[model samples]
Target: MGRRIGIKDVAAAAGVSATTVSHILNEVEGKRVNPETRQRVLETARELGYAPNGLARGLRLKRSNTIGFVSDQIATTPHAGRIILGAQEEAAKHDLLLLMLNTGGDPELERKEIDLLLQRQVDGVLYASMYHRVVEMPEQLRSVPTVLLDARSNDPGVPSVVPDEVLGGRTAVRELLSHGHRRIGFINNVDDIPATHGRLEGYLRALAEAGLAEDPRLVVTETADAAGGYRAALRLLQAAERPTALFCFADRMAMGVYRAAAELGMSIPADLSVIGFDNQELICDGLYPGLTTVALPHYEMGARAVVQLLALTGAQDQGTGPAAQEMLPCPLVARASVVSPPRL
Candidate 1:
C-alpha cells in the first residue's frame, strides 16, 4: 500500500506552515483564524487526498475524537442498523467519529471489545443491547466514560438510556381496557429479561388499577422470537377460557399471534383484538390486518445516547465527575388492530 498523505504534504501543497494547517483542521474554539487561510488549507488537503493519522494526532492532543460503540447484536438484526444511523448523525454534529464493535451477545467477547477500544484510546464508550437485559461489562471500563442504550446495567458506573418499556407496556394494556376488554392475555419470551419484566410490571399494574386479578394461564411466557409467540398464541386460544384480547411483547411475536388466530379461523378485533410493542415500521404496515403497536423511538434513543456520551466525556476532561443518567420516554402510536369486547 502507498504511504498515507500527512498534514505536512497538505501544508507543502498549500504553501503554508504545518502549524497553520493544524489550526485550520482542528478549528480551535475561541481562536479565530483567517477565512482565506482555512479555505486554502482545505483546498490543499482535498487536492492531495490528505488524511490525518487520527491515532497519532489523538496521542499528541490527549483526545481521540472518536467514541467506541459496542452492541450485543447488530449483524443479523435490522434494528441495529437504525440505531447506527442515529448515532452516526449525532456523531457528525459533534465532529466525532465512531468505532463500532459487535459482541454477538457474548459477555466475554464484549469484555475483549471494550479493552480494544480503550487501547485505541476512545474518548468514551456506549454499550447497547439488542434485547433489554442486565449486562456485566468489563471491570477495566470503570475508568472509562461509559453509557448504555436499550438496556440497563447493574454497574452504577455506567449510566443508561433505555426505552421506557414499563410505560409502553402500560399503554398497551390501557388501550385494550379502554376498549372494554378485561380478559386480556400477555405474551412474552421470558419474565426474566429486564425489558420483558418491566413491560409485564406495567401490564400487572394496569390490571390491578382496573380491579382485575391476573389469571396465570392467560400469561404466556416463551422464547422471544416469532416461533415463541406463535406457540404461546396457540396455547392461549386453545385454553378452555380464551382471552378476548392479547398484548404481545414484540412485533415479532405479534406475527405469531396473527398466524394462530388465522389458523383458528378467528377474525381480528371482531373475535380477538391484539396489541404489540416495538412499533417496527415494516411489521406495523405489513401485518395481515395491520397491528396496533407502541412506538419505541429507537432511532431517537440511539442519537441521544451518543450526544449524552460526548457531554459526559467532555465533563471528565474538565476534571469533573461523570454525567448524570438520561432516561427518554416512550410514546404509543395507535393503528387498527383492537376493538371493544364482544357483548355477552
Candidate 2:
C-alpha cells in the first residue's frame, strides 16, 4: 500500500515549519507570512497531491461544508435536469458540496431521508418538492437550518422560496382579457392546495379588477390534471354561458381542455382560446396550436433556493438573522393558443 502524503511532506518540500504549514492550511495567521513563501507552500502541496483529510478539518471547525438536498423523484422527472443544474451552479459558487437524496414522491420516505441527512451532519437542508403544494416538514429539521423550495408550510421559521403563483395566474388572465376575452372560464384543481388556491385567488382578482362579476358556473374546480380538465371542459362548454377563453391551473389540464374543445367542433383562437400554467414542454408540443402559458422559472427557482440556503447557513452560523420567506416572480410566454374574442 502507498504511504499517505501528510502536511509534513509538503512542509518539508516548502522549507517551512510544521506549525507554519498548519497555520497556512487553516487560514489562521498568527504571524504575517511572506506572499512568496505562501505561494511556494501552496505549490508544493499541490504538486504533492496532498489533500487535508476533510473529516479532520470538519472536526476542528465543528462544521461540515456539505449541504443536504432532499427532493422528490427529480431523477425521473423531465424538469429535473434544469433544476439540478441550477442548484449545482449555486452550490459551486459557495464552495459547498450537495448531498442529494430523492424521496421518490413518498412522504414517509421523505421523512426517513431527512433523518438520514441529519445523521450525516450536514450543515443545512434544502427541501424541494416537485410541485407547488403544502408540505409537512419533519420535526427533526426544526433544529437545523432548513429551506423549502417550491412548497409552502405553516411553520413561519421554515423559510420558503416559491414561484409567485398569484402573479403568474393574473398574468395568464390579463393576457386573455387583453385579447378581448370577457367570458373567460377557469380550470383549476382542488382549492385546498396552496398553489391551486393562490391561482384561484389571482383569477378572481383579475375578473374583479376588470369590473367583471364572478360567474360561478364558468369556474370548474377538479383534479386540474389532463383527465379532470377534459371532463370539466365538456361540462363547461355544454353550459348556456360557454366561455370563449379558458385559463387552466396547469398545462396538463389545458391539454385536456384542447381535447374537449376539439370534440365540440371548436378551433383554437377561432371559436375558443386557451391559456395555462407551468409551461411544461410536452403540453406545449402536443397541442395542435401550442399552448400559451405562465412560465414558472423552475430552474432559476431551484438555483435561488440553493443560494438562499447557503446564505442562511452562513448567517445562522454567524448569528446574523432569522430565516424568512422569499418568492420569485413567474413570467408569461405567449404562443398560438389564444386569440381575440369572436368578432363583436
Off by over 4 Å in 2: 1-52, 105-112, 317-320
Model number with the top TM-score: 1
- Candidate 2, residues 1-344, lDDT tens digits: the string is 48887889989999999888877876885678888888888899888988889988787887788888888877665777777777778878877788899988887887888888888788888888877777877787887888888886877777888888788888899999999899999989875776787888889889889999999999888886899989989999899878999999889899888888889898897999999898888888778799999988778977888878878877976888676677788798888998898874
Error of 1 at 324 (Å): 4.0
* lDDT for each residue of candidate 1 in 1-344, tens digit (9 for 90 to 100): 59788888888888889988988887767767788988999988988888767677788998888888888778776678778888888988988888999988777777777888999888888788775667766677777877787777776667777777778788899999999998999998675776777889889999998999988998989887788899999999999989999999988899889989999998887999999888887888899678998977678878988877877876776887664556566677778899898775
Show the colliding residue pairs in model 2. Answer: none
Please give the lDDT score at residue 291 for candidate 1. Answer: 91
Model 1, position 224, has a per-residue lDDT of 74
Error of 1 at 336 (Å): 1.9
Best by the lDDT measure: 2
User: Clashes per prediction?
Assistant: 0, 0
